[model samples]
Target: MANALRTFDADVGSAPMDMLSALFEARGWQCDVHSTEEISGKVKGSWATYQLRCIWRREDNVLQLLCLPDIRVSPEKRAPATDLLALVNEQMWLGHFELWSDGGMLLFRHAAMLGDEGLLSLTQAQALVETAIEECDRFYPAFQFVLWSDKSPKDALTSAMVDAAGEA
Candidate 1:
């Protein structure tokens, strides 16, 4: 069968890292942090570039931290932009909390129903993408977390961009 199409986007700032770390730690999620130049790759002529990613995962859910620097900001501007960092911090805190709550609810509802193999299937994958989109949308207006959910891995990558943009 052909692969299903996917899409999503979100940009948030930096303050949520510690909160996320704490929350996930309490839940026993394994957290891994890495630094890289870029997190996404483009197709032959695509304009989109991938963002750096920090991933937190447990048995059920995955939380991502994305670092995106402003394309408009040049290397010549060496000093960190305080305004950008503050914006990112606000959005990440709100967005991550919303995602956490929604993911928890979905996992609670579907855990037994999905089981192990079912949870690993395309249907479950789609549900996860959808849940993230829905939760993020519900919380976006309140916290200014801007993102697009296209139901693609690209969307997930974009989320990291939102996260990274905060720190950048």
Candidate 2:
């Protein structure tokens, strides 16, 4: 695939957001360019299809990505979900999970600061999306266990950590 990110110079006002949209289009993600500063899409994972949103803050030179699984934590379950997030975030090398208190929506969030140059490579964008999705996939079952099955955060995390040696 061509690096859509490389096509634009910094002089282009919306270069970062434009390159982001092109990269998503090239990868055939269900991309929506909400505005010059935002893009949203869906990504299929082993456990679920995640909703992805990317927002570019020109003033701060920050590019933020949010990945959300198709699950909601009821008010009663938010405390346990919060525990699970703490456990889950502790182990991650990239994005961290967040539980929106008012709405009880769980999501993975990561942001990159582009500095004054305000440049992002396609590879960096890919990594940001992939890392969010991957971490969501890896921890999805734990969230299920906590929210639905009433497992303790530690136990749910333990259950989710088990890896099958090989496909049958």
Candidate 3:
């Protein structure tokens, strides 16, 4: 078996990080371009405010994204948080949730291999940001339940998955 050929141009290597910065600014999010390889920003979501960061690795041709929700899991709650993350990660397709060992901060992380040419489209960048925010919003309540309300991982996941039909 053989892999399909992916096309790329020399200029493709230079545009991704800039494009990402522009996209973030266009969305009115607070965007900061920290050198040519990284950008960080803040976005407001329904359930919580989020910190979003993107790092472009030129040598590896990879783009890494991290989205952190406002909620933080205390050290004591890290056990249940880990359980909840495991269950949540199993249900994810594009990205997975992780509890950082340093501060027990929960975040959604995804990385894309842009191939040898390192081409990244604006649409791809937009999708990455949107997906992270959407997933975090969907699962925020479950984290709250497990960390704050002392709910079991299964029960918290169930509560978070329930879709409310309409506004009261």
Candidate 4:
């Protein structure tokens, strides 16, 4: 069978970011991936806008994805953001959202191990992007509530779960 004899020439290829860049661009995201170390782009979701970044870690042969929301958790909101993020993180499968300490930037972070596991396929790469963006989009309103309102973390999370029984 043709499949049985096919060989993967891992040596001839570049880093995983190359394929990821192409994939991101093809999906209508204007991606900047010319640098050997990292790629950055923007993605617009129905619920929120996110800044996207993919970085190559040479030491670990891993590609990491970061999706950062434009909102910052104010010092006053940090407590609620922490509680909300913890609940949301428990619900995530791939990456978890984090609130950075210094600037309180809320970010979605996920990583893929490359070399030892073989190259990251385009499908796999896109899946990572989908997971990150979906989580960001899914939980965006929770953060917004925590940042701008007087809602508790649990209440904020509950508010984002809009009910749509028959609609898709």
Candidate 5:
């Protein structure tokens, strides 16, 4: 087996970070570009405030997103929370939520392998964030139901996904 060749341009070292910064800025997000390796911002959705963090691995051309939902899962609820996250993870397309048991914290995480290439595209950066927001927004209510309402994982997912309103 051989290692895959990275396609990133040597001169375009900042492409990924720059693209992320610009994309978040365009959305009026105040992001902290404290380092080339990471950029973070907070997006307030209708349901909860989400903290979005993007980390770039220059050596591998991999950009990963760590989105923390505002809710905190407690130790007592860890068992059911695991069930809830598992169900939601099965339904997700972009990322999955992980339980950091040490703190009973849950976070939605995803990564994009850009591979060795030229400068990252603005569209690519935007797509990553947009997908994250969409997935987080869609599933947040389910997490609430599990953590707060004592709802079963199956029912939580159903409540989160059900569209009761027919064509108006």
Candidate 6:
């Protein structure tokens, strides 16, 4: 990997979002949290959504992370960001997963899949999230977790692959 894709030893913390945001900002990167509702018009339907987005410029290319709460995947009518909190309900089955680009970045998403009654234990839910994060780090040295949103930039993967291949 090129120096441009250098890895940072992220400090483990209770607040994942705050920790991530601070880590990136310390490196001169910018992070933003955008709601699906805010960018809904840009997509198609008026679905309510929320996301945490991070952006950084690597020379001419831009890197980004758009983190979305789990409810964004539900087939419910449009609701506010608060509705996403229900995704954390005790009866849900939680799991975490990460999707990484060949270049060297990752998109991490965790969900507490709702069931008929209660939520999964915190330990169980967290285990899934931990697994996903670990997998992403193992696969991509410069991974950035993001939400699935229309406003999220799309070129990071392609650019990273090109850069990686060029180094070879």
Among all candidates shown, the one with the greatest TM-score: 2
Residue pairs with backbone overlap in model 4:
none
Per-model TM values vs. the true structure: 0.25, 0.88, 0.88, 0.85, 0.86, 0.24
- lDDT for position 69 in model 4: 78
lDDT of each: 0.30, 0.83, 0.82, 0.77, 0.78, 0.30
lDDT assessment of candidate 4: 0.77
* Candidate 5 vs 6: which has more TM-score: 5
**Candidate 2 similarity to native, TM-score:** 0.88
List the lowest-lDDT window of 10 residues for candidate 6: 36-45
lDDT of 5 at 41: 95
As for candidate 5, its clashing pairs are 6-116, 7-116, 7-117, 8-116, 8-117
Using lDDT, rank the candidates from best to worst. Answer: 2, 3, 5, 4, 6, 1
lDDT of model 3 at position 74: 91
Model 5: worst 10 consecutive residues (lDDT sum):
1-10
Q: Please give the lDDT score at residue 108 for candidate 5.
A: 87
Q: Candidate 1, residues 88-166: lDDT per residue as tens digits? A: 3454422333122222211101111333322223333334333433433333322222222222333433455565456
In model 3, the Cα lDDT at residue 51 comes to 98
